[model samples]
Target: MLIGEVARHSGVSTRMLRHYDSLGLVRPTGRTVGGYRQYTTEDIRRIFHVESLRSLGLSLRQVGRALQDPAFTPSALVGDLIRQTEERLRREQELLDRLRAVEHSAPTGWQDVLRIVELLHGLNSSSAARRQQTVLTSAEEMPVSTDMLAAAVLSESDPNVAGALRWALARAGGDGIARVAAGLSSANGDIRQRAVLALAEISGDEANAVLAEALENPDAAVRRHAALAVGGRGDTAAVPVLVGMVVEGANDVDAAEVLGSLAVDATLATPIMHALAGELTAHPADPAVRIRLAQALAEMPGTIALAELRRLATDPDPAVSLIAAALAGVLEERAED
Candidate 1:
């Protein structure tokens, strides 16, 4: 193609192309016998890319240097582009901050949007991990006012999801613990279960106390979850209470889970062993609960436990049997040393 064709495709004027050629920035592939500059497909591509870079804010000098640099790897280019993106995000954040002062979006605004955008700009694996840390720290420091948690949980967006989780963690031991725990206890099965699982992260006596109080909720769902959370916490003080629930339990599913999660002592060991042993036999029909029981046994593997497992090795569910056998061997080996 000629200079005019190259100019049309690259959005550079013919005079600019001539100037670039004079500077040795880009030269025509050949010259026709008629003395017209003839450009190649490759030359056009280079011009297009250079013009794109210029549009993206790089100086023409920088584009020329980049074209000359043979040492630039694909990885290096990607890293440099990422750095540029982060810089842009920072500038955007500054603009957003100014906008916030001018027109407040207290409950909802461009400020939060910009914050999330900045967080995501250069989001590599390492950055994502750092974000997880920040989310935790920010949650701990910020008061979990209603709007914050409401935004985080309700919005399925990343910043919102992360923000909500962090806020939840921060607000964990607050008075809302009672209400949230109540939600866990009284909501539909899935919501209740999810709430209790999230509540697992909660710490301190205040959290456990809230859970304990939930046991007295008029709703049976609340009572069941309170039992599980207490048992799972393995606070030996709650052992008597948990054991009562175990004895009178209607939901063996929950019972097995709570028991399996418990960090039992030798005192509770005998009872745990009895319940687990019975589960390995009587509930052969309930594979799920049986697996949980086996897991608990594995956590406290011993000679008697190994003997029980050795028998199960040839049983119907090879997975359960094999895992039990493996735990027994590992425990025996660990003890031998």
Candidate 2:
């Protein structure tokens, strides 16, 4: 086949075939009287092979090596190609996210577009202080989109910056709840914990629903955070986790407060008291656990909690006995008042 025929037959352009010949990648085997480039069957096959490698994102140099160098293994080269392709995909996805965030902001003019872009850059800055400042000082005139704020909240590692992002998400209202909620399903425990923390700051049914869902998360930290948030919102579904938190001494004071608040409703008071009492019974030997439970019971309202507190007042451990006696007296004095 001549160059033109080869181009037409193999979908390889004549210029590219000539370039390939010049690079000694696929030289023609014979020539006509006019001295035009002529390709043998094997040469045409090599041209197809080069195109095939190119389609897999191989550079011309790599393709030449792949075709000519018998020592060149495809394994290392293919792995490298995979990594490069993944990096390209990640960059493209980030660009798409930025574009979507900009579009979601609904910029009215070039100035608004620029401001939003600037805000996005600050939010993604390597410096935690810059990210925090961007969130805290983001102009009311050009509010950052809820999606961008939620994304920032989910990925932010610095505590101060995360707090600022959460506050911004709260100010943005329930709109960012679903985006933040996506972090709850992340395999990373830190991300799931962040999602719950952000959701806790966001008010509304949607955020509350996500918090309630997170109460069942496998990560104990995630569950404790969600339980505290949802329990404060009067979601009784967090009762068990809150009780567990009190028993485990993980943020037990805050957990106890939330449990006490949940017990305000008359119907929930008994179960709340019973759950605390059950923990005390379950850990008979762990005096520290019992003391934590006793303290938590003091937060509970109604006669059930008072009775449990009074019973704990005589506990064997002097520390438990002393604290429970002090708390029971406080509860009794309050009842009289």
Best by TM-score: 2
Model 2: lowest-lDDT 10 consecutive positions:
300-309
Error of 2 at 25 (Å): 0.5
lDDT of 2 by residue, 1-337 (tens): 8888888998888898889988988999978888876998888888889989999999999999988889889999899999999999999998999899889988889898899899989988999889888888884555788989888888899999998889888988888888889898899988988998999998988888888888878788989999988988888999999988988889999999998888889899988887888888899889999999988888886545777878888888898889999989988888888
Candidate 1's residue-wise lDDT over 201-259, tens digit each? 56668778777665665555556666777777785444444433444444545665555
Tell me the TM-score of model 1.
0.42
Identify the candidate with maximal lDDT. 2
- Which segments of candidate 1 are over 4 A away from where they belong? 1-172, 185-194, 213-229, 236-264, 284-292, 301-304, 314-323
* Cα RMSD of predicted structure 1: 14.8
TM-score of each: 0.42, 0.91
Each prediction's RMSD to truth: 14.8, 2.2
